[model samples]
Target chain A: MSGKVTNGAGGSGDGGDGSEGTPELDAAFFARWMTAAADAVAREADRLTELDSAIGDSDHGGNMRRGFEAVREELGEEVPATPGAVLMTAGRKLVSTVGGASGPLYGTLLRRAGKALGSAERVSREELAGALRTGIDAVAQLGGAVAGDKTMLDALFPAVEALADSGGKDFEAARTAAEQGAEETVPLQARKGRASYLGERSIGHQDPGATSAALLVAALAEADTAVEPEGDADGTGSAQGGSGGSE
Target chain B: MVEAHGGKRVGIVLVSHSKEVADSTARLAAGLAGVPDALVAGAGGLPDGSLGTSEELIVEAARRMDEGAGVALLADLGSAVLTVKTLLAEGDELPEPARLVDAPLIEGAVAAVVTAAGGGDLDTVAAAAEEAYTYRKL
Candidate 1:
């Protein structure tokens, strides 16, 4: 196993069960497969927060590192019984463990997504899309923020839109748009969070939340193809929702 | 200052969002410390570990320091401090000898580190960390 080989464009997709017998996207499989997503997050934790330091807050990587670490710990010794359970518990951990506005917003996204996932092991892209839509709405409700607010929601909204627009057919295409949407937040003034307090000062710097959002999309894309690294940091770095890695 | 870097070892643990970010910070921090300073080790988040939490990162940073006077953990927020504490308690053994300092991350990490490099104890090092939020106070 390559302990530390940096893949700039994301993914070495040979992960998750790509077998024919296990060719099912069932809960057990999804639970098993998401490890790739987990690894991607863990490996990139610090970089994510560093990007945040440039713009909004400098805690994105730190926050996600905490949340995902919890996920890995919870999944320890025993896998989550169902996809929904996995997400719900993860979301709850974020809400309880993480601090800041991101805690609730991201926790809501996961919990909402998990609730929609229910006990089923495997969910099609369509199923996941519905759940993500639920998550997006949940975030909006929880954070009282919307697109163009220069937050993770800005990146998240566009990705979901792209997903729905494509009828949930193209994960890569959707990821690209999500990434683009996240990057678009750079020029936006902060309408929320401490960065919002900074007003015009928040401009020019990349939105940390949006940057993380793009990482999520990149992880999702990695899940689908496990393709070789693309160009240097091709991601838009938006869609950057996080749980603040709080305790 | 105990004046130890020339005679002792130091460890570093930083919490960032990505591996690139972590490495970048580690590289810079390592450079800032100088070769004669202390031994610095780091880890990043990429969803590729036994656990993927920020607290885990802090612990991982702590663990990397095998023979240092103690560790100087730099955090991004108030709660990041809490997570690091939780991680340390779960059998991670952080006595007074082994310290965890939560400083103001972006600029504060460097300042606290610079103070630590001068050979301060955990309390003094941590106090330096507070400077991240109040550099102007100096």
Candidate 2:
């Protein structure tokens, strides 16, 4: 689901200049990204719960829905002054509203990433990528999980890695990487989270957390495409040209 | 009713996914400590009374238990622990110097309540709760 740039105002730099190699996303962009993520979560809540029912406590969908709805309401109440503030506020809301491991894990990711972003009015793609890596690391440390543990990190680590390596301009590539990573979890035996309690039964079920993570990354790509339709001709072109090989 | 032991002791908090469990455990711990007036509170369930932990409830319980000394929190199950961890990481919502004691829920609550009733400080109360992890049930 693409989130149209309804409020492209505020923040220090207006990143739509065609001369710049990469656009500097502002607070509004991050807000729009979160809102888009919330919308996606709401749309796929049932699927998430279904996936969780297979291995988890079957509350992932409801937990994520409640948390993201709170984020949307908080963002609607008052858009923060900077990207970091927006992320931090959203993280706090998630931590308080969502009552599960996902709550703290996702909350920590956003909070740590927001803290890394500091109070910058605008952030470059590279800065955003690095900050996301920092956030993912925080989630890993909080959850005591790694890539092959069949958790959200499975999707998140690959997506951030792809984004960082692409000089932080290839949100589409990151999205695809995240989707592939999520799919790869279907064959993995979980070593972390509640799913690990199921032991061998955890196999053959796609991780709900990784699936939602993919949706989040997909929303990011959608936000990027929506923000500047013509900024990344290659991005938009490849996106429209279908999911072809990006090597 | 147990009298105040000359000073406020470390507050004890019990957290669980079910409100009933937390409430009863709190009652049982206080009763076992022989101090019916010990500073202890129970937090559990979601706002809708569902079977899930709530940070709002946990913070509220912590605030109620905080008596200028500090609070020692014990949680049951997955999200209960995670929710407490989240609050601890935030560090600004709960009372100053709150801690999440790692121990068996009922045993830890009993140990913490007894120590607090005896006017134990934060560290001592926490250590007492942790020591319950190795207590012999036989």
Q: Using DockQ as the measure, which candidate wins?
A: 2
> Which DockQ values do the candidates obtain, in the order shown?
0.04, 0.62
Considering the true interface contacts (CA pairs under 8 Å between chains A and B), give the fraction that model 1 also has.
0.03
Candidate 1 — number of clashing residue pairs?
A: 60
lDDT per residue (tens digit) for residues B25-109 in model 1: 6667657756332445444443353222344454556766645566666654323443444344323344235555645554655
Error of 1 at B97 (Å): 45
Least accurate 10 contiguous residues by lDDT in model 2 chain B: B1-10
TM-score of chain B of each: 0.68, 0.92
Runs in model 2 deviating more than 4 A are A1-23, A228-247, B1-6
**Interface RMSD to the true structure, each candidate:** 7.4, 1.3
Clashing pairs in 2: none
Q: Per-residue alpha-carbon lDDT of model 2 for B1-138, expressed as tens digits?
A: 233345987888899989999989999998889887448888988878887888889999899888888899999987788778878876499998899999899999999899888888888888889999898979
